[model samples]
Target chain A: MSNDIQDLKQPLAKANAGLDSVHVFAPATVANVVCGFDVLGFAVNEPGDEVVMRRTNKPGISISKITGDNGRLPMDPAKNTVSVSVEHYLKSVGRLDVGVDIELHKKMPIGSGLGSSSASTVAGLYAIKTLLGDDSNPAKLLPFAMKGEELACGHGHADNVAPALFGGFVLIRSYEPLDVVRLPHPKDLWCAIVFPDVDVPTREARQIIRNKINMKDAVTQWGNIAGLVSGLFMQDIDLIGRSMQDVLVEPVRSMLIPDFYEMRKMAMDLGAVSFGISGSGPSVFAFTRDEQTARLITGKLKQHLNSIKIGANTYVSTINDAGPRVIG
Target chain B: MSNDIQDLKQPLAKANAGLDSVHVFAPATVANVVCGFDVLGFAVNEPGDEVVMRRTNKPGISISKITGDNGRLPMDPAKNTVSVSVEHYLKSVGRLDVGVDIELHKKMPIGSGLGSSSASTVAGLYAIKTLLGDDSNPAKLLPFAMKGEELACGHGHADNVAPALFGGFVLIRSYEPLDVVRLPHPKDLWCAIVFPDVDVPTREARQIIRNKINMKDAVTQWGNIAGLVSGLFMQDIDLIGRSMQDVLVEPVRSMLIPDFYEMRKMAMDLGAVSFGISGSGPSVFAFTRDEQTARLITGKLKQHLNSIKIGANTYVSTINDAGPRVIG
Candidate 1:
């Protein structure tokens, strides 16, 4: 649908045309939730990414600024997940001619295994959708967000992006058909997250995991997965804690994070419901039932890391139920 | 708490001692439900076993008669699972001196992969518990029933015995702690079961399965497991049907069952919700939303087997909610 110059200008000249700009915030997410490997994830309230978008008369999308990345994120529009995803979305909706300038603010740490890129990409996609007045169901935007994930990581897994986009816990039951099922969780569930200043590359972290696992271990893992889903539906917190065990990836991936077991023991002893690596490595999370315990866990965990001469950042919040939203 | 001989006689002579005899019927079960191998199972209403137990003056348990087994079952009390489980129960409760004679009536086919042994063993346990006037929680008898499973098969897996004892759908989340969680299912759900007259030894079926599996397949299996559990909780019938897929066991075990894929296709075409090999199979089952569909499925499946000159027994029933009951 090629539009003449006069026709393209007519819509923007109207009194109530689409907004001139949009600002959106998308929350960070914890992927590979314990027993759920590549299948499950949940969103949190704090430590999110921010995106600012402005419509222009110019032809294509471009990255105006990238902050908090410490020169790590790519500046090229084709190389960055945010612009690439926005381009995919624009092309899908036949709005490629509509120009936009994107600014990604990485409020969360990059490569900390806390879905940092997913948050930014989701924020950018949401901003563009709002700018173009596409009010279709947010789920329709999932594939475009997934393209961003594929660009950031080699594999286009939705465990992180689904929750970051949909809010709450989401299960990617099948990737070929892109079946994402939203799961119920306890209302009072709290998460205490900590990112220790230890470098663990996502590519290398994924490479260390075994390609094959014992059948007995697979049975145990699936049983725990069943129990975890059952616990969420039944709202049984204790069962959820008991079922959050991982036999396949954690054993090998934990080696990448320093003092992982020690931190886990400390968290468990302090009455955390369950503790494990958030995403791949470095970042760890503790599930708790109350805000007081969540804050207490983060406090003690930060102290332990400091005692070991390691710097860390911590956050405590309940599960996020609303995904990306407009701020201005 | 040693009872003197004269004291035991005094109690027997009292007006209200223990019952002279009791008879119980325990329902058959389908273990390794699709994606949930070694973890999930559900009980059926028909094709179960009956057991009759009588008090005797002799101070030891004995099997007086074994019927319907085609001269295959053992008569020795120590060798039979029914009597062995009874002996364990008696010892655990300090009732070793109590005497009982057992009669095993195999109402269902043996070695049919439909939990035939589990039914008889559970029936015998229930009968003994009733005759001795021990009206405790039925779950306390699981370990003793598991002993019966160990006698029947080399492994002490609880997938078969758990549903037979607990009734409905059961999940054995952990084996070491013996954690069993009962799950809810739709009230209108029905099962169409077919037992083909073929031999697939449980030991050989187990041996054919690979000791190790690809991690990617494990993830897919667990994703389906989680989805199935969630569907059960949410009472979503369509989701349940979609998630009832097994990637690990079905691919290998299906080779042992004749016309497995054809039967599955026929069932699905007939509007059955899901179809899979029951237990290790030779026996297979189809889940349906209504009794009419279930009956239709079984009728068609039986005719197909007959056309192929293969003998089969077909049944249609809803899930059994009661584990075991005294007949007289």
Candidate 2:
């Protein structure tokens, strides 16, 4: 893999000579989509992370500053997801001799169950690639981003990172060969997301899942997965909504979120096309056809969360087609 | 369901006033297409069954003739799958008193694991509908056809019957609501099918499957399912072939088919896109992009089976798009 990246750098390096600094904004993502647990995800527009990179004459990598994480995130270059992935990217391109300084900015909450770490890592990687003038396919940078995910979370799952890096909806068809598939969706599709301020550790949530499940449920889940993919291709909103039903994960994980079922009922009544917990939850999402409906759902959900004496944040945006963009 | 069918009969009754008899042909189908397990299926061009329906003065459905089944199929209206399903259809349409004489010709081998019974049942249903001038959607008759599948295999699965009735590829996304979704495929897709003359009972094949499976395997299977659906939607033949892997059923069921692995290796070596057991066992299939590759595969597979002292029938044709066509 490193050899492949080095080979690509030879042709593009001359084109990237004059760049000294770069800044990027990588959007937050929702993983474990309904009926698509661990296999599907999509990107949203708000609550992301930003990273600024500067080339230096020094020999290695370092973190110049950190902000927006409430001092909870690591500042060490070896430990932080942002600097760690950048180091790997530099190594792959045979640029370890070239020093780079990274400034980490966590625009989203840590452990919000909305791929906070993934955003930071993808932003850092995107910034480094831009600074080095490597304009290869963005998907080529997925492995470096996944290395950061493995550090943030124990598993190196790609559902969150793939969408955050490539934009749009993606299906990680297989992990062995790292087969990621970008799916088609309606242009008018919008998302209403609510992140309730609650403590639900990713490790605990994962342990609660059953190691084995009935074959009958597996068939139902795969059937729904097939339906969901079909719905995306056909651009049928109604089919996508109906096929979002998830038999596994939600039943056990919903208990961790206060009034998850009640929120789903309210969202459905308010014309949300589909409702499900985003990532591992405390953060939940609903898909809608129009921007008005999306805003309405987020507003109502935010109010409900406040009434329950829980702090929350809400966002309404269409699916993000451009993943990370240069903001500087 | 009965009320729904009866309500649809009022306006189309006059259009069928003069028809006295109808002959229809329903194509054979391959269910459990690789990773699809019980939800995916497609129709083939050849090796189908023919049914001839005649309006008579009698008060109920009666089987007048049975041929090509080698005296194995039942003649009783209540016992035969063709007449039992036809009886159910007539009753559902509030025409239980209508008289119909049916003649079933089993053009394909019985117990070939290639949906022999589904073709006969779908053909009979189509013939009855055409003879009575009920010009409704062919999918409306799926439930009655499923009844025939129940009698034949003891499970009312629509994988075979749906494709035979609706044509092309289909996904039975849900069973409770009986949701069936038609999918798109590459026009050049061709299938090479082989039915080795061996007895692998459907009951035994089903019984061998573990009721409980590891969650990891389930995840892998669903990922492949999503990939396969995406491949079909995108018309990516390579993706479709890559995603047609069956980790759940093929591992255990392949033990039943003699030299299954060897055959798969040979087929792959011959440039067949994908290879797997079709439906259950005793019958296997390979997909290719062109007719020459398909014919070559079937010819080589037939020769291999003959060398092993196993009688086999081979077919090479593109996907059957016009299912259950009227012959007379």
Candidate 3:
């Protein structure tokens, strides 16, 4: 045991974590803008994840505590998505072997389409990066947060991940080497998210999707993907809405979420430029040109979901331009 | 009665007979943005056709005459593409019979894949749109210009028309109803167009394409289309490049153009982020991140085409943010 103790050599730690106070903000994101499937997204600001981290004399990387998760999440670092991402980022940047403590305040729900985990991942990594004197650039910080995302979703999908790191719309070309690009964010647009209280765990929802899509459907999917991306860049609301339709996933997944059709219809009827499942459903997001429409969509979604007897959390927000910032 | 009818029409007075002083700037364009196949394009500044239109007391839309088209373009308003388009634009909006004179300045060659005909169409329609007080929106202007393009190529394809009307990358959804969406313009990217003085008449080129596509290829094409549009929207060069591949028509069409393979290889090898046959080629456009590389590509294309002793014209440029602009 004594010899093995040398082999272990005390787990890696966070550097300069306790030396100062740090705050980080991570943006909410849209994943799978139609044909991008697993690899395109942009950030929104209105409702996002903010963390205020203060360093402590704590012996290792540990969660000082958490709030707003309704005491549902674990405090254990390995089991916690945010804690692990923070630890991973510090270790990769050679900020390891230093003691630190992390305090994450979850502003958005874990399964919300607002990219709750990605925001948290960004916030956690950012908090640690700041505590360590900003050890990495956006490019460098991406993978660390991505690893955290993989832990939560079982596979890496950067549409949401890249935005969480870079704070804009992003296109993920490949996950193997992690090729990602940030797209121009259309000005004056807001994103409205509706998270129903019903839980359709990511694993379960993913399991229902066919492993291989029919090539015909795939092409249509990609066409729409291109169209949607084009629409976003051009700021064409009608085209963006056209490009958001996904015959592949929505048909199957929407069935799992109660009143999905009704709520979606309501949102569209109320002028949502686009609406679709935010990553595997139970939660959804809609695009609006203005704040009034966003609020209207949120209210409509809430009302529809309620009529189905399901409570929902609705946030009418804007694109998250500032990816990760810190607060206490 | 017969004498009165003969006296009434004869050659008709010149529509544009008075002032001859107006600056004009038409933009070169890229029709069919890779995977979009039948429907995507954008106009670029420089290397465009400039046709200055002026007003005259003489009634009816007859050209006082023209330059730069080498007397190849018809003088009859009903027969000329630009004339017909202007006539159509006016008729469609119920603003008919405007008097105008015109001159054409050939900035780009007659058959460069860089949408040479679109330049003429846009210039004429734009001038008319301006002279008519701009009652139509960007969307409405497209059909008029498209009809003009049909004169040059004998068919209306939006990839060229949409961009010519709008300033950025555009998606032509369906031609029947003329649905179009302008996507965002990429930043900091350069484009090099090499027009080998060989003509691949649009009529023959369209015939060369097989009407029925392999479902497999169709699927791939749509997927890439989605990816490509998303790439542009996301501003991901690699994705755009990857998505530029065409499994449908490029292969067959490139065969008709001499040395097409070597030229493509040259463009790719010369650090071009992407390269493709411009419209119905013999002309090709290569893209890069900077002006230096763009020139480098243009030079490579010129040399390659020349080695085979094919006459060529090369233009080093970038994506056109403003499709068709009026010269003040």
Candidate 4:
């Protein structure tokens, strides 16, 4: 509409023409890998987040344009998870004096339990690092993004943060500053996630569960979590199948998802190792050893949801190798 | 001594002979695996338990004789951990009509944190099962052994039972019946265990720790447990290293061990990826990738303990593929 606005568009075009600021694609992730409850995640290889960041003299992070968030994502850089992380990371490494403008293409659905929000935050921070010429490795970049994530999620839970920082299965090293560990992800594994047509706010769903767990139950939960992680790392299919059980969060949260019970039952009957509420709720994920089983599990879950007349979207993604990426 | 005592000595002519009735051996195990505390354990190939069982006209399970207990262990059949589990397992399965005579060879040191008591109970039950001639699978015998464990450890904990029953690295599936799931232990891994000469009674050690855990810490604990198990399953050395850290149990238990703070530092400095308190206390275990690292960690741990003049035994072992075996 104006000459200045049009000029802004020209810089964007030139930046897309293979500049130093390159495009990287980071995938959507699944957090709270079943038994892990609040501290495990895996970045998927497909259907991810794209960020476009360019160097600037503005002395602060700027979200030039926001798309794919239903236009509700904040353009004001200070309030954004991605911008805040980038700023914090830069400042911590004594480079906050520089600045960048990041254009976010938040392709994944918000609050979808597919780690849509975390993916964006991870991508944004990574894009800023590339734009600002920070060659810091993933381990170095983790804390900065985790701090930003605390702002977004309202709690410093690393179930999402660890995977978002480093692809594959992730372990929370420590919670204070969000130290993280990237566990080995399966080389030949794919995930089938079903996003039901529903909404269960993470905060609201989390509050519905009891604050205290019986010591007996707590010990069992920890043992199962250990078993689940061991199953993943050992590539022990039967062990993984059994370890996917979670007694702490799933029973309480599954009540929020319409027909969650029926879907879970049918999926297991159709050969899913296990099924549980994803993140807060309204989404559920299952593990399969091969593509056929994955597809079969997905179909079984969908049929149950459909019989109850609930709409949902299913995704087939391999374990995520790249967490956050950039695009023009 | 008497003519009957002389007869008993002459008949056991075969050095490792298994009696026609039953001969049971339960492998020594490392429980807790650091962050898992009361809920994780794995059987090792070394330091096993040996029990010989024979059919008797007695109305109930009876402990006829005990060797290597240093005159300290209980003689009452119903009160002992091993005998109790066998009785409970048999009673629960509706075979209360049967009777047995158990001879426990307490080869492993009592209160060693190598699950000597559990090994005793498991070995006793195994010997009884062998005598029964029903050829029972592991699932059938779990209840009997678990009940026996409850008698000794106060609360029936699985960090020991699961590994002894199934062998190798194991995850406790549930506590009710003490259900268990065996995990795939990595081929290249080795554990260097340091058994401090000092004693930390399991009962007293458990009491010193806090009974309640905050939800935040609980989440982190479970997260790390899952990560550690995943690391073992995937054979992801990095994840295993990262997940081996503890926030719940170690922080408190470490205070009880003298110079534990410094010992851990020395172990880590010796290239061990992770070091943690074994079971209740005193014994410490370090995880490494290769034999060379294992030796290094063992040497370092011994040296540190000695520097503080804390006498201890150090051992390096791979994950034992073989669990309980026949004595013949």
List, residue by residue over B1-328, the lDDT tens digit for candidate 1.
1232223333233423568999899999999999999999999998899999999997899999999999899999989999999998777776788899999999888888889989998998888777877655777778888889999988888898889998999999989777789999989899999998889989899999999899999999999999888888888889899899999999999999889999999999999999998999889999999999999999988889888988999989899989999988
Separate DockQ for every predicted complex: 0.76, 0.94, 0.15, 0.43
Q: Chain B TM-score per candidate, please.
A: 0.94, 0.97, 0.89, 0.85
Model 2 residue A6 distance off true place after TM-score fit, in angstroms: 4.4
Chain A only: TM-score per candidate: 0.94, 0.97, 0.89, 0.87
Best by TM-score: 2
Residue A22 miss distance in model 1 (angstroms): 2.3
lDDT of 4 by residue, A1-328 (tens): 1332233333333443324454556677777777777777777776677887777765777878878889777778778888888777666555556667787787677777777777777787677656655544655566666677688778766677668768888776566545566666457666778888787777788788777666556777787776666566666667667767777778888888887777777777767767776677687887766778778877777777788788778877778766665554
Off by over 4 Å in 2: A1-6, B1-3, B16-18
Cα displacement (Å) at residue A146, model 2: 0.8
**Candidates in order: C-alpha RMSD to true structure:** 4.8, 1.4, 8.3, 8.7
Q: How well is each residue in A1-328 modelled by candidate 2, as lDDT tens digits?
A: 5555766677555664747998899999999998999999999888789999999998788898989989998888999988898888887777777788989898877878899999999999899888888878888789899999999898899999999998999999999977899998899899999999998888788899999999999999999999999999999999999899999889999999988998999999999999999999889999999999988988988899899999888888889989999999
In angstroms and one decimal each, the interface RMSD of every candidate reads: 0.6, 0.4, 5.3, 2.5
Q: Model 1: per-residue lDDT, tens digit, A1-328? A: 1223223333433423568899999999999998999999999999899999999889798888999999899889989999999998777666667899988899888989999999998999899878876656777778889999999999888999999999999989888767789999999999999999989988999999999899999999999999999889889999999999998899999998888999999999999999999999789999999999989989999999999999999999999999999998
For all predicted structures, in order, the TM-scores are 0.94, 0.98, 0.70, 0.74
Computed on C-alpha atoms, the DockQ of candidate 2 is: 0.94
Clashing pairs in 1: none
Residue by residue across B12-85, what tens digits does model 3's lDDT show? Answer: 23233323345557788877666666677777666888877877666667766666666667778788777788
Ranking by lDDT: 2, 1, 4, 3
